[model samples]
Target: MRVAFVSLETVSHRDTETNQRFQTVLEILAARGHDVHCYCATFWDDERATLERDGITYHGIATGLEARRSFLIRLPFVLAASSPDIVHVHAQPPAAVLAASWGATLARAPLVTEWYGDGGIDDNRWTRLAANRGARILTPSELVATWIRERGADGDRVETIPNPVDLERVRDVPPGERVDVIYARRLDEGANLESLLLALAELRDRDWQTTIIGDGPERAMYERLASDLRIDDRISFAGDCSLEERIAAYRGAHVFAQTAEHCVFPTEMLWALASGCVGIVEYHVDSSAHELVEGWDRGFRTTSEAELADAILAAGDLEHRTFDDRFADYDRSAIAEAYLEQYRTLEEAYGLL
Candidate 1:
C-alpha cells in the first residue's frame, strides 16, 4: 500500500508525543513493505533537506509567512504526482486539514485525519467541517473521540486508538539508590505544578525527595513557587530529558504524581505506569488521568492536598510491583497492527484493495 502522511512537522523534531507517534507508525508501516511518504513543514535549516530513512520518504513543505499559501498551492500537485492510496493527516494547524483534504480529493484517495487530543478543536463550524471532511477520524482517547462526536462528526467514523508506547524502552529498569517521587510535564500555568508543591509541603514529615522533569515558559515561576513553599531543597528541576533519561527517571521513582488538568491520555503517565511507578493523580473536574488508575490497585485518585500527601506517603508499599499487562494493548506492535487494520478497512471501502 502507498500511504501519504501529512503533518505540520516531521518526527525529526522528536520533542513531542505527537511526533513520536507518527514516527513509530511510519516505521511500522514501512517495515511491513508499505511505501510511506511524509509531507510536513520545514522550520529549521536542517528540515529543508529532503531524505529517506527506515524505508520512508520525507518531504519538508516550505515555512515562513507564506507557508500556508505555499502548502495549499503545492500539496495538490504533489499528491497527484505521488498518487497515494490513502492520505493520513494529523489534524491541527487547521490549514493542514484544509490542504490535505484538497490534496486527497485531487489524488482520488481516501482521507484519514488524526486528532491527538490537543484541545485545539471545538464546536466551531469551520473546525467541524474540516474534521468531518475525512473518510475517518482517529483520536488518542475515548474522551477525545467523544469531543469530536459532539462537534458534529459522525460517531461511526470516529475511533479511539491510544498513543503507542515503546514498552521495551520504558519498562523494568534497575532502580537508583534514592526512592524519588517524580512529576514530569510542561511547567506552565495549566500544568498546575503549584498544587503538587502544596501537596508535597503538607508531607514535610515524610522522608521523600521529588524530581520534577520538563521545561516550559513558566519554569522560573515554578522554581520560585517551590522556593516560596520552602520545598525547593526537596525538589529538583531536571528540565527536558532525552528519551533514555526520562525512562531512567520513571524507573528510579517509587511514585509518580500528575496534577495537570484536562490532560488526554498523557504518554508520560503511561510510561511511568509501565515503568512500575506507583501512580497518583490529583483529581480535577475534567481530568482524564483518573482513567489511568480507574481500577488499578497500585494507583490512586486524590481529591485534596491532604489526600494526595497520604497517597504519596503510602507509595512506598507499592515498590515491589513490576510492569504488568494492564497497558499491553498500548505497546507499539499492538498499536501498529491496529492502525494497519484501519488502513486495510479504508482501502477495501475505497475499492483499492
Candidate 2:
C-alpha cells in the first residue's frame, strides 16, 4: 500500500512525542513493505529536501515567513505526484489541517487524521471542521477520542490507538540497584512538580532520595521550589537525558512518581513500568496517569500530599516485578499490527483493497 503522512516537522530535526509516534508507525509499516512517504517542514537547512531512511521517504517542505503559503501550494501537487492509497495527517498546528484535507481530496484518497490529544483543540469552529473532514480520526487514548467526538466529529469516525513502545529496549537492560524515588517529566507548569516537592518535604525524615529527570522552561523555578521546601540537598536534577540514560534511570528507581495535571499515555511512565519500577500517580481530574498503573500490585493512586508521601514510602517496600503480559499490548510490534489492521479496514471501506 502507498501511504502519505503529513506533519509540521519530522523526527530527523525534532524528537517530540508526536514525531516519535509517527516515525514508529511509519517504520513499522515500511518494514511490512508498504510505501510510506512523509511530507514535513524542513526545520533545519542541513536537512535534505528529500531523503529516504529506514525504508521511509521524507520530503522536507519550506519554512519561514511564507511557510504556510508555500506548504499549502506545494502539498496538493506533492500528494498528486505520490498518488498514495491513503493520506495520514498528524493533526496539530491546526493550520496544516486544511492543506492535508485539500491534498487528500485532490488525490482522491481516504484521509486519516492522527491526533495526540495535546490540548491544542478546544471546540473551535475551524478545528472541528478540519476534524470532521477526515475519513477517520485516530487518537492516542479514549479520553482524546471522546474529545474529538464532542467537538463535532462523528463517534463512528473516531478510534483510539495507544502509542507504541519498544518494550525490549526499555526492559532488557541490566537491572540496577533501585534506590531513589524518580519523577521523569518536563519541569513545566503543567507538570505540577510543586505538588511532588511538597509531598516529598513531608517525608523529610524518610531515608529515600529523589531524582528529577527531564528539563524545560520551568527548571529554575522547580529548583527554587525544591530549595524553598528545604529538600534540595536530597534531590538531584538529571536534566535532559538520552534514551539509554532514561532506561537506566527507570531501572535504578524504586518508585516512578507522576504529578502531572494531564497526560496522554506518557511514554516515560510506560518505560518505568517496563523497567519494573513501582508506579505512583497523583490523582487529578483530567490526568490519565492513574490508568497506566491501576490494577497492578505495585500501582498506587494518591489524592493528597500525605497520600502521595505514603504511596512513595509504600512503593519502596514492594519488589520489582518481571516484565509480564500486562505490557504486551503496548509493544511496538503489536501496535504496528493494530495500525496495519486499521489501514486495511480503511482500504476495504474505500474500495482500494
Candidate 3:
C-alpha cells in the first residue's frame, strides 16, 4: 500500500501534539511494510527535493512553514504525479486540508484528515468548508470528534481514534520507588494540580506519599503551593522525567490522579492507568479525561476536588498491581490495525481495491 501524507510542517518543524500523532501514524505504516511518503516543507539541511529515512520517503513541498501558501498551490500537482493509494492530511492550518482535497481529487484517491482539536483550531467559515472536504475525519477523542462534526464534517464520517501507547513498555519497565499516589501533567494552569494539592492538604493527617511527575512554566508556583500547604515533604517534585521514569512511577503508585481542566486526549493518564494505577479523574466540561474512566470498575470519575480526594482515598482499597491489560485496545499495533481497516474500507468504497 502506498500512502501520501499532506502536512506543510511536521514534527521536524515542531514537536506538537498534532505533529507527533501524524508522525507516529506515518512511522507505524512504514514499519509495517507499507510504502509511505509525506509531503512537507524541507526541515533537513540544504534544499533537497526528497529525503528517505526509516523506510519513509519525504518529498519537500515547500522550503519552510513561511511558504505554506506556496505549498498549497503546488500540492495538487505534486500529489497527482505521485498517484498514491490515499492522501492523508494533517488538519491544522485548515487551508491545507482544502488544498489536499484538490490533491486527492487530482490523484483519484480517498482524502483522510486527522484533526487534533486541542490545537486551538477555530470553527470559522474556512475551517467549516475544510472539515467537509475529507472522505474521513479522525480525532484523538470523541470530544474532538464532536468539534469536527460541528465544523461541517459529517457525523458518520468522523471517527474517534485515540493516541496509541506502547503496552510492552508499560509491562517491561520496572516500577519506580513506591509511592501511594501519582499525578502527572505539565505543571501549568491547566494542570489543576491544586485540585489534588488541596485535597492532599485536607488529608494531611493521613500517611501517604505522592509523586508529581512533570515540569513546566508553572512548576515553581506548584512547588510553592505544595510548600505552603506544608505537605511538601510527602510530595516529590519529579520535574519532567523521561517516559521510562514516568511509567515506573505509575507502576509504583496505587492511584493515578487526572485533574486537568482541559484535555483533547489524556495521554499521561492513559499511560498511568495502563501501568496499573487505579484511575481517578475529575470531570471537567472541556476535558475528556473522565470519559476514560466512566464505566471502568477500577476507576472513579469525580466532579469536585473534594470528590477527587475521596476517590484517591477509596482507591487504596483496590489490590495493587504493577501492570494492567486494562487498555490493551489502545496499543500502537491495535491503532495501526484500526487505520489499516479504514484504509481498506475507503479503498473498497472508491473501487480502488
Candidate 4:
C-alpha cells in the first residue's frame, strides 16, 4: 500500500509520544515492504526535499517546523502530486489534517487522522472540520477517542488502538538486580512522583528499595519531596537510562507504580506490565492510566496514597515473574497489523480496494 502521512512536525522536529508512536509504526510497516511516506516540515540537515530513513521516505513540505503556514499551504499540492493509495495525517495542528484532506480528495484516496491527545484540537474548530473531511480517526486510548467524539467526530468513525511495545526486546533482556518498587517517566510537572513518594513514606517501616527511572528539570524537586518524606535514602534516581536498562528494571521490580497527573497512554506502564511487574496506577481526571489496569489480575487502580501504598503491599502475595506473554497482543507487530487492518477496512468501505 502507498501510504502518505502528513505532519507539520514529526518526531525529528519534536519528540512526543504521539510522534514517536507514528514513527515506529510507520517504520515497521515500511519494513514489511509497504511504501510508507511521511510528509512534514524538513528536519534533515541538507536541502533535500525527500529523505529516506528506517525503511520509509520523508518528504519535506516546508523548511522547518516553524513554517506552519507554509506547510499547510503547500501540503495538499505535494500530497496530490505523490498520489498515494491512502492518506494518513496527524490530529495535531488540525490544519495539516484538513490540508491533507484536500490532497486525499485530489488523489482519490481515503484520509485518516490519528489523535493522541498529546496536543492540538483544543480549539475544536479544526478538529471538527478535520473529522468532517477525513475517513476515520485513530486514537491510542478510548479516553482519547471520547475526547475526539466530544469535539465533533462521529462515535463510529473513531477507534481505539493501544500503543505497542517491542515485546521481543522485553523477552530477550535478562532481569536486572531485584528491586521492590519502580516508577518510570520524565520527572516533569505531571510526574506526580510525590504521590508515590508519600505512599512509600507511609510504608517506611517495610523492607523495600526503589528505582526512579528517567530524568527532567523537576528531578531535583521530586528528590526534595522524597527527602521531605524521608524516603530519599531508599530511592535511586537513574537519569535517562536506555530502553534495555528500563526493561531490566521493570523485569526485576516487583511492583510498578504510575501516579502521573495525566497521560493519553500509559506507555511505560505497558512496558512494566509486560516485564512482569504488578501494575498500579492512580487515576486522574485527565489521565487514561486506569484503563490499562481495569480488568487484569496483575493490575491495580487507586486514587489515593493510602490505596497505592496498600496495593504495593498486596502485590507481594503474587508470584514474581520475569515477563508476561499476554501483552504480546500490544506488541509492535500486532500494532503494525492493526494499522494495516484499519487501512484495509477503509479501502473496502470506501470502495478504494
Candidate 5:
C-alpha cells in the first residue's frame, strides 16, 4: 500500500527521540513491503533529499510559509505527486487536516490523522467537517483520545496508538558505575520541572546526582533553579544529547524521573524502563505517566515534592539487575511490532490495496 505521511511538526537531522519515533515507524512500514513517503517540515540543514536511509523514501517539504500557511500551499502539490492509498497526517488544529482532507478527496483516497497532544480546538465547525471526511483519527493514549472526541471527532473513529519505542538500543547498554538520575524531554510549560529540581536538591544532600538531558526554552529556568537550590555541583546539564548519549544516560542512571503535567508517550520513560531504571512518575491529570508505570513493580506515582523525594531516595537503592529483568518486555522491537499490528488492522478496515 502507498502511504503518504504528512507531518507539520519539526524534524531534526540531529535524530532526537521524538524524530526517531517517526523514523522508526517509517522504516518498519517500508520493511514490511509498503510504499512509505514522509512529507515533513525540514527543521534542520542536513542536505540529502529523496534518499533511502531507514528503508523508507523521505521527502522533506521545504516551507517558509509558517505552520498555519503550510497546509494551504503544499498539500495539493504533495497529494498530486504521491497519489497515496492513504493520507496519514500527524497533529491537529484542522488547518492541516482540512487541506489534507481536501487533497485526499481529490485523489480519491482515505484520510487518517494522528493527533499527538493537547493543542486547543477552537474551530468546532471545521473540525466536525474534517472528521466526517477522515477515515480514522489515531491518538497515542486514552487521555488524548478523550480530548479528540471532545473536539467533535466521532468516538468510533478514534484509535489509541502510541509512538513506537525501540528497546534493543536501551537493553544492551553496558552498566555504568555512577548513581545517576535522568530527566529527558522538552523543558516546556507543561513540564513542571521545578519539583524535580527540588527533589534532586533533597537527594543531593543524601549524595545523589542528576543528569538532565534535552534542550528547550525552560532550560535556563531549570539551570537557575538548580543554582538557587545549591545543587548545581551535583547536576549535569547535557543539553539535548544525541541518541547514543540518551541510551548511555539510561544505562548509567539508576532512576528516571518525569515532572511533566501532560505527558502522552515519553520516550525517556520507555528507555528508563527498558534499561532497568526505577521509574518515578509524578501524577498529573493530563499525563500518561501512570500508563508507563502500569503493571511494573519498579515504578511509583507521587503527587508532591515530599513523596517525590521519598521515591527518589528509595529508587537510589534499587537493584539494577532485578529492575532490568522486570521491564525486559518494554523494548523497542516489541513496541514496533505492536504498531505494525495497528497499521495492519487499519489497512484491512480501510481496504487499502
Candidate 6:
C-alpha cells in the first residue's frame, strides 16, 4: 500500500521520546514493504539535506515560522504526485493536522493522525476540531486515548498503540559494570526533569552515577540544581548523544530512570527494556509510563523521591516475566506488521483497493 506520513517535527528532528517513536514507526512501516514516505520539517541544519535511511524515504519539508504554511502549500502538490492510498499525519498542533486533513480531502484519501502531546485537544481550540475531523486518531497510551475521547473523538475512532522498540538492534552490549543510572529527555519546560535530579540527589549516598541526556531550554536550571545539591560530580550532562551512544548507555546501565510526569510516549524506557536495563519511572496521572511499567514487568513506578530510589534498587534484583511477553508485543517487526494491517484496513475502508 502507498502511505504518506506528515510529521511537522518529530524526534527524528529532535532527539526526544516522541520523535524516536515517530522514526521507529516510520521505519517499521517502510520495512514492511509499504510505500512509506515521511514529510517532516528541516528543524536543524543537517536536516536541510534529504536522505533515505533505514527503510523509509524522508523529505525535509521546510523550517521557520513559515514551516506550517510551506508544508500546506507544497503538500497538495506532493500528494498529487504520489497519489497515496492513505495519508497518516502525526502531531497534535491544530494548524498542521488541519492542513493535512484538508490535503487528504483534496487528494481524495483517508486521513489519520497520531497524538502524544498533553495538549491533545486542550492545547488549542483548533486541535479538538481537527482531530474530530480525521478518519482515525492514534494515541500511544490509553491515557492519551481517553483524553482524545473526552475531547469528543469517538471511542472506536481512537486506537491505543504503544511506543515501539527495535529489539534486534538493542543487543546486550558486552557486559559492563552496572553502576550508571540514565535519564534522557528533552530539556524542555514540560520535561519536569528537576524532580528526577532531586530524586538522584536524595540517593547520593548510593554508589551510582547519574547521566542526563539531551538538551533544551532547561539546561542551565538543571545544571544549577545539580550543583546546589552538591551532586554535580556524580551527574554528567551527556548532551545529545547519538542513537548508537544512547543504546550503548542503556546497555551498560543498571537502571533507566526519569522524572517526566507527563508522557505521550516513553522512548527512553523502550530503549531501556531493549537494552535489558531495569526501568524506573515517575508516577503521575497523565503519564503513559505506567503502561510501559505494567505492560513490561521490567519497570516500577514511585510517586516520591524515596520511593523512586527504592524502586530502582529493587528493580535491579527482581526478575520480570512481563518483559519477555510484553516486550514481544512492542518489538519492531511485530509493530511493523501491526501498522501494515492498519494500512490495509484503511485501504479497504476507503475502497482504494
Task: Name the candidate that leads on lDDT.
Answer: 3
- The local lDDT score (0 to 100) that residue 87 gets in candidate 3 is 94
lDDT of 6 by residue, 154-247 (tens): 8888887776776666663443334457888889887788777777777788777877889989898999989999889988898998777788
- Alpha-carbon lDDT of model 5: 0.71
Estimate, for each residue in 1-353, the C-alpha lDDT of model 3 and write its tens digit.
99999888899999887788899999988989999999999999987899999999999989888998889999999999998999999987889998899989999999999898775569798898888878899998878888778777899898888988999989889988889989988887788999999999988999999999888989999889999999999999988899998999899999998888889999989999899989998888888898888889999998887887788888889999888897999998999999999999999999998
Measured against the true structure, the TM-scores of the candidates, in listed sequence, are 0.87, 0.89, 0.98, 0.97, 0.79, 0.78
TM-score of 2: 0.89
Candidate 5's C-alpha runs over 4 A off are 8-24, 39-55, 58-83, 102-108, 118-124, 131-133, 186-190, 202-205, 215-224, 322-332, 350-353
lDDT for each residue of candidate 1 in 1-353, tens digit (9 for 90 to 100): 89999876666654666666667778878877888988876645664446677798878666732476787678777877789998998776656787888999889899998887564356676677776768889988777777778777888899888777778766645544355589999877789888789999997777778999999999999999889888898899999987778777787778889999868777889888887788999987556678788888899999888898888878777654446567888888888888888888988998888
Give the C-alpha miss distance for residue 12 in model 1, angstroms.
Answer: 5.0
Model 1 clashes, total count: 0
Q: What is the lDDT of residue 328 in candidate 5?
A: 43
Clashing pairs in 3: none
The local distance difference test score of model 2 is 0.80
Per-residue lDDT for 1-353 in model 5, tens only? 78887766534544444445556667767777778887765554567645455566666665422645755567767786678877877644466787887777777677787776644334467676655446788777787787778877889888876665555655555555455678888787776889899877777657777888878898899999899989998888888877766777777788889888876676668766777678899988878777878676788889999899999887766686412544444444555566556556766776763
Tell how far residue 186 is off in model 2, in angstroms: 2.1
By TM-score, the better pick of 1 and 4 is 4
Off by over 4 Å in 3: none
Candidate 1: stretches off by over 4 Å:
11-17, 42-50, 60-65, 171-173, 285-287
Predictions: Cα RMSD each: 3.0, 2.6, 1.0, 1.3, 4.1, 4.4
Name the weakest run of 10 consecutive residues (lDDT summed) in model 5: 321-330
lDDT of 4 by residue, 184-301 (tens): 9999888999999999999999999999998998999998888988888999999998999999999999999999988899899999999999999999988888998899999999
Q: Write the per-residue lDDT of candidate 2 for residues 1-353, one digit (tens) a residue.
A: 89999887667767877777878889888988898988977754575678777898878776632476787678877887889999998877556777888888888888889877665356777777776768888988776776777778888888877877778786666655455688888888798988889999999987878888889999999999999989999899989988788777788887888888988766788888777788889887666678787788879999989999888888777876535457889888898888878888988988888
After TM-score superposition, the amount by which residue 124's alpha carbon in candidate 3 deviates from its true location, in angstroms, is 1.0
Worst 10 residues of 3 by lDDT: 117-126
Looking at model 6, residue 16 earns an lDDT score of: 53
Off by over 4 Å in 4: 119-121
How does residue 189 of candidate 1 score in lDDT?
Answer: 74
